[model samples]
Target: MKRRALAVTLPLLLMALALLGANALITPARADEADAPALAAVAQAGANTAEWTVEQMDFTSRYPQGFVFTLRATSSGGEIVSARVEWMHRPHTRAKEPISVRRATGEIDPNTGLITATWEPTQSTAVPPWVGVYYRWRLRDAAGNEFVTDEGYAEYADTSRPWQRTETDEVIVFANGLSDEMGDLVAAAMDAQRQKYLDGWGQALPYRPRVILFGDMETWLEWQIGHQDTTGLGIVRVGVTSDEWGGTVQVIYGTEEELAYGTVLHEIEHLYQREFLAGRTVFTPGWFIEGDASFYQLDDVHRVATDYVADLVRRGDLPVLLQGEGPVTFGRNALHGYYLGYKFFEYLDRQWGIAIHRQIMDLLVQNMPFTEAIETATGQSVLELERAWREWLGAPGVVPTLIPTWTPLPFLASPTPMQFGSGK
Candidate 1:
């Protein structure tokens, strides 16, 4: 797999092409259309082609969005006249519209010389996200002769694409097209999480979520294993690195149309929760972890959360609402824990306002009693909160008398450490 940096600055290189327009200084006048002698010069120029070979073929350059790239080429025998570079994306667009590359073409000499063109990228709503830098350049001589080639193409990945980075202390995402905004949105979520850490609501995660995107899954996976450390989960799976607070996330492909933004937000926050509370037992179950992530992200995650809730409501499994951390494990047909946990967080946030986490965070930080903090944050204790939740779930008689228990495993002998890229 080709690995890509989760660099924040890189965006897709957009090049819109136009047909040979200005600077076709010498097209034989159509009035002279049937005049062989009149068109002979252009014919001859077309015959002895400048053979525009791209020296930059597979020459990777870091192209941030909206920058100009000057295309280069050498003419044969110093025998050519002029050269121009035209751009095209065949996968998109048709004859009706052409992509315009501003200040698109440059000049060589009237003799066998080099041709150069500049690409000033502009955003396009029509182009779908894709990997590979692909641009077909058309070259011509002063006599109106021309040649075209796609050797100028390049493929880029979005920084928000999961597992595509690890270059910093903080997670970063580089992306283009529709979802480019996801990186910062997730950053905001991470900020919320950090507040949880600061306020003592949860154990501090050692690392930040750095996201990078590719046009799709292939490149996403390609960049993923590039930095996969063998410490925890193996290839295609995120692992714990020997280093501090670090892990990876693979952003599966989707859009706002098919799934709510909550799906991505939920998974990313789960990654943080897992890594931060690594090897620590939580009195709360995984549902709370997932639910909290979803709940906190409701501005974007509401529909999906509702979907889960609705599914349970339809199934008549609503009895599990206050089932007391129902599932020790997650997603094995359990709802009250994960889904309800989200509702719990949502409930707390709504009734108490979002800032309550700040106070809860403080409780966790100073090691204030969890129940006491719940009482302090809202005049209700943990049991009172559960009772209210039961009333809301229509399970007025339900009660949760159990607290989750986690016993740390005894230290086992360490495994052999191996170097990256050294696996057999």
Candidate 2:
């Protein structure tokens, strides 16, 4: 659930992870779901004194693909018209589309006063392991009486992978065929700094985010959303996070220190954005999203972003801030927006204190315009804020005239510490 920051090093590896173009894209729902009948209207409660109820619900591993979903229910009405299971990987958020499936045909027992249904979980690669699936049951009876159950969780664990799992009060890290150090690093980072995140955001997340580190390149590539030819780039798929699978961070293995100080925290910041900041506004500018993530990272975001942009400015190559796509670009070392946005945050932090981060997020969640959100959060208009930031940066007070002639510098030889899609 973290946004990709362009401020990272090792452009190739960072690019691979940032784009997520290498992971296999599997549909989230079962194939049959596409053709499943639409849900009927909710059946109103009727004369039956005893309402329908779900007696038991559980999940068991169906390795290599999905899980076994089982449940038992009873209805006083006796004749059940329909039973369904609904689930999502993230918490406190609705699926963009229906993720409910009708129970396979079954019979209700009169003497036992119960009915049972079992089915396989959706095997879509999108439903990777370590994600806590929030699920519930819905049932309707012959008399149109309806029943619904409280939500429960099922972890679609990848039993096939040799994952070393670690848990803390704040996070869960899963490392496959990698050193325990990596898992420990991620866990410790969250354990130590979760309170800092809580303080900055002014609230806690609805659910803990999962950090998944893949040790092998092939497995990493195999799990990506699309086929990528990394032949010439020397870009080993490094890291990723997704809002789709419950704010999970998926990355190639890194040392405990690397994860503790690197993209791990950056991506976790994204989870905070979703749970606390960007409410209901599904699409915001990349500048705000990635810049906010970079600001929260363990490293010195101000210095890094400032230096990157300053260098561009010295060369007369600084692009307009709010320009096309807001700083995320495809070529080498091109995510100026990350730093530009970070500078914006830095200016806000200096003038308004860290609470401004929460304030801005609050305004954004209300679907306010970006300029208005900044003005309201900081008590200054957008132009005023921009002028102040440029003054601090020792650059011109206004956006520099954009130079159309620009090319990326050569790829860096070393990797930098740095850090999607709907379910099918």
Candidate 3:
């Protein structure tokens, strides 16, 4: 079904709308998967598929409590046996390589596929989470035959054990590599991010997010895919309550080597936007969210937009800046959102000063319509803001080529003239 961005436009509309219609049938974020029981216990799957009782599962490292498990599958005819195990948490890498399959106990009946060998950890062996290993019971009945268990997702050793008080908010490195201070540093970064999330969005969303940061893309993608399977919800990189598993913010600042602190500040501003300023379902304009965040982080308004809008103006395409319509995605599509958002936000900050943005946010929370809120807060309607945005793009004042990497000058009372000014 189609969704709308904002209410009807006025006759003096300068900027074109940015947000497009989207389906709003969002889903819950938590995933709860069922376990398999077709291991050691008698189970059947269609014809020729025999049952094998799963015996044991062991984890090499830490996972979420009560969730990670392993199992041993044994054929009823004394044919085959094996273990399905889970990997401990690690960086979310998407690399694919042959797993070095080994065990100290090589107790496997080759004819029957039975093994009871326990794993021995060496100096350099890292296993990913939920790495289920299976042994097929290849046998010869009256007629030569082949068979494998259909017990999907065999259990692993329950590494998700009861938590200790000290373990709360602490690191659980499987191979034991982290120093106390390093672990604390990681904890502090996470805790600070968490607090930022809470502070920005506490009133509307009132639960702690179960945050997962992986070392590589594969692990992260796997968890997200599994989450989609379990919850029937494709994550949209938006904020969530406790149930939502994958919360994300891009670390890059559009360039190869911008300071990471700005990225953090930018994302945190989004948290505040989601919680306090915009609609729960109806997304705020991307321009506003990222722009505000960038504005807050850098504390600049004119030049940032000028750096961008000036380019467009020099190219005779200044109309893009005048389009103050809502940002299509809420906290996402950031370049389309943040870069431009930052610039636009900069212009508005210069236009109305910082206080007006705050006033606009308050008006939004009070359920004021976006256009009406702009008018009420700044005493200038959204259209006026657009005209102000357009004029700021190519004002005759000699804007220097070396726009400040620092701060922007405050906006003066320059309303749109009866006729639009031409030429830069």
Candidate 4:
């Protein structure tokens, strides 16, 4: 998907104009009666003799809410049968239809030989802040001829937030309800080790991924679509790169400094995974995805995992890593799999170097079976790999739980409250 960082600084006058445009539609001049010579000149300069021609097209306001627009068209057959304005989010690669396209309504100006129309987009849930708009004109003539203007672009940016945006060479951070210091810190953190990520992952971001951090749960929930619950869901989704889907890291507020920083890296890692496995149709396990994310965030995650998994193994609570045959990222002991999966990658890295990660990801991109990929990467059978990992962690060959037998207790009612002074 094509992406660009939009840095629109909306001033007070611009805000007033945007608001006014949203409320009213104004046609500056009669398309047919006014500027006829200019229209003719445009047609003469860039007209296809056989099709309807667009003499002029541009936006009156580029505000997300109620941006105003005007377009002028001319026809060769003296019959401009129909005209319409079509627009979708800019830099889009996944939308199947225009976000909105309404018929342009205005009288043809006889003097100017042009058809002009105005569109005033209103402020509503449909139009939000920082939305990019790509628009064009479509015209039809009586001879069944059609004309489409070259694509035009704008943004439905909210000057209200006056968002504090920071950027490094690799990533950009957009923050609302966050202090400039905090925002800059986050950006600096990303910049400090941007190369480490790009080098380790063996891929670069398809677009500059944005880290949008909301200040608190209230603001995050209010901004969210569908009023979804954001109770403890730190990171929401790395959505499609469009205004409609919002191509950014959409997540809730982070209260703790370390946790928040780690969350940012974790979500960023998710973006790398998305680009790496873009077109594959196979079901890559979640354990690998989340585990790899954890590993990326902290290189010493295997040490942490070793301690945790070792405790589990001593308690006979260590679950089988590759034998569950279900999702390992979430469940009663979900984190066990995450850290354990990190150790799995850690083992491979130690034996084969970080190159194994790229090799396994390549296998995944090819839709290869997960076990086969691991075995291929490690040069060990799946079972053998599991046994070796267990050995590396000093975990016993078998983990048999010791369920304590339950002895029934006799039911006893509390003795009636003893009289204040009579405990017999």
Best by lDDT: 2
Pairwise lDDT winner, candidates 1 and 4 = 4
Clashes of each: 42, 3, 45, 7
**Poorest lDDT segment (10 consecutive residues) of candidate 4:** 415-424
| TM of each candidate vs. truth | 0.41, 0.71, 0.40, 0.63
- Candidate 2 weakest lDDT stretch, 10 residues: 415-424
lDDT of each: 0.41, 0.58, 0.35, 0.53
Off by over 4 Å in 1: 1-171, 176-209, 223-248, 256-260, 267-282, 298-300, 310-316, 319-324, 327-329, 334-336, 366-376, 379-381, 394-397, 400-424
Flag regions of model 4 displaced more than 4 Å.
Answer: 1-128, 131-142, 147-149, 225-247, 250-256, 298-307, 324-327, 397-424
Which TM-score value belongs to model 2?
A: 0.71
lDDT comparison, 2 vs 4, better candidate: 2
Better of 3 and 4 by TM-score: 4
- Report the lDDT tens digits of candidate 4 across residue range 181-283: 7667767666655765766667666455555665655554443445444436763432222223223434343443532355666666666665555444444
Better of 2 and 3 by TM-score: 2
Residues 3-45 of candidate 3 have per-residue lDDT tens digits of: 1112122221112111210100011111121112332121222
Q: On a 0 to 100 scale, what is the lDDT of residue 249 in model 4?
A: 38
After superposition on all C-alphas, the RMSD of every candidate to the true structure, in Å, is 20.0, 11.8, 17.9, 16.3
TM-score of 4: 0.63
Write the candidate numbers in order of decreasing TM-score.
2, 4, 1, 3
Between candidates 1 and 4, the TM-score winner: 4
Q: How accurate is candidate 3 locally (lDDT)?
A: 0.35
Decreasing lDDT order of the candidates: 2, 4, 1, 3
